[model samples]
Target: MTPELLRARIKGGEPLMDLDLRQLVLTPGDYAGAVFMRCDLRGVNLAGVDLRDSQFIRCQLQDTIWDGAQLDQCVFHGSNASGARMRAASIKEMNWSDSQAIGMDMSEAQWVSVNFVKTDMTDVCLKGASLKQVSFTECAWGKADMSGTRQEQVLYMYGDLTQALLQDAHWDGVVCVESDLSGQDFHGQTLQRCQLTECRLEGCNFQDALLEQTNFKGAFMRGAKLINARASRAMFVYADLQEAHCQGGRYTQSLWADACLDHADLSGADLTQSILHRTRCNGASFMNAELEYADFSYADVSRADFRGSRFMRTQFHRALIAGTRWGNKAGVLEKDPLLFEAEQWSAGRPTAPRAGY
Candidate 1:
């Protein structure tokens, strides 16, 4: 198709479907609200075109240059958009799904509410892009570079995250499910309310970061560093946190039910109002920590240290305390530990205040 022929057809409002338009020379013209289905636009130079609200379904758009195009409210479904360049494009309210966007370069683009469902985004470059309220569902990603991007409220529901590079990215309210973000650096970043359920976070650094109300349910957080992190009310239910460093952190009201805290150092940490029911706390440390209102019911605290810890209303109901060290506690001391201690474990024990009045 020639440039004049294509312009005439578009101006005449003709159906541009199932046509071989690989020979068309695109000029700066208005193609807005145009619908092209099953069209082979391979290697088309559609740069700087006005394609706003345009729909392209099952189109062959491989290596197409859409850079500086106005793609606002555009729909691109079931299209082979591999190696397409859409850099610095204004793409808002776009709905793209079931498409192959592999090796697509969308760097420095302005995206808002851009949804991609069931799409293949392998080796996609989104560096320095600004995204707001964007979502990716059931997408197959591989080595997607999201470096230096400013993102807000992004939701990723897929799990096949092969080598996602998010270096120097600013995130707010990011949520992921079953995603493997292992070995990512989140140091000192504010990740409030970020839910990473059933995800693999192995060797992830969250040191001194603000992780308030972040959910890590059924996550693998082994060797993760959370030192001095303000992670109050965070959920780690059924998470394996073996050898994780959480020393001197504020973990108030956090839940770790059936989770593994073995070999983790929580020294001088404030675990007030926390719950660890049926959890494995083997070889953990709580030295000089505050355990007020914390519950450890049915948990195994074997070989754990509680030296110089201050506890009030901290329950260890039916918990295995064998080989656990307890000393310098500010709470009620057991006077008759050899006798009536098993009775105390069976029933609620009586407490006496320190006679300092």
Candidate 2:
């Protein structure tokens, strides 16, 4: 139908149509007002075309090639564009909501102010792309290749970016609220003021990343690897980081109130000037770690290891220390219980050691 006319216009060099253009190779043409609704445009080649303000609503555009195309202000609502190739395209201010774009290769493309709301873009490639102010709200971008992408001011609320390849990407001022970033690698990335609340980040890797003032409240990061990370003024309130490997990480002035760190390894790490108020570190390892000016008030350090760790001016008031290996390398507390209780508590304060914990 319209696809035959488009091919005739491309061959006869007449003009392109504005209707359903499915399975056609009409390249090097201008396609203004191109509307492709309910069309199957699989294997169609529309490369090097100018499609200004075009719309593709409810279309099946699988394996379509749109390389080097100019698609300004275009919309792709509820379309299926799986395995499509859109490399190096100039797509500015496009809206692509609720689209199923699995396995699409959009590497090195220009996506300025694009909206990808509620789209399923699994295994898509965006390597070396500049995505400034892009909104991916409620999008499923699982296993997407975002490596080396410069993403500034991106909002990814309720998005599933689990296992995505974000290695060495610049994510400054990115907000990822309620997103699943589990098993994602953020090694050596700079993340400032990032909000990650109530997300499932189990087994995620953030090794050696500069995380200044990041909020990780109520997130589940059990068994995550954050080794050698630099975190200053970061907040982890009530977060579950059980068995996480954070060896050699710098936690200067970080706040970790009421967070669970059971069986986590913090060996050779710097915990200087950090707040660990009421934090549960049961069975955790802190061997040879720096604990200068760190607070462990009312914390549970039972069955925890702190051998050869620096504890200069570090508070240990009301902390449970049964079967704990202290800096003296002993399995028991050396001080008398009554004398230690008398040093901090007074008369009639019900200070009979608080009824043995």
Model 1 spans > 4 angstroms off: 2-8, 11-13, 332-357
> Which segments of model 2 are wrong by more than 4 Å?
1-18, 23-35, 39-41, 189-192, 328-357
Tell me the tens digit of each residue's lDDT in model 1 across 3-111: 7777677778776899998887887888887789999999989999988888899999999999999899999999999999999987889999999999999999989
Candidate 2 lDDT, 293-334, residue by residue in tens: 787877898999999988766777678888888756332223
Which stretch of 10 consecutive residues in model 1 shows the poorest summed lDDT?
A: 331-340
Which lDDT values do the candidates have, in the order given? 0.88, 0.82
Give the CA lDDT, 0 to 100, for residue 64 in model 2.
90
Q: Pick the candidate with the highest TM-score.
A: 1
Question: How many clashes (backbone N, Cα, C below 3 Å) per candidate?
Answer: 0, 0
Q: Please report the TM-score between candidate 2 and the true structure.
A: 0.78
All candidates: TM-score: 0.85, 0.78
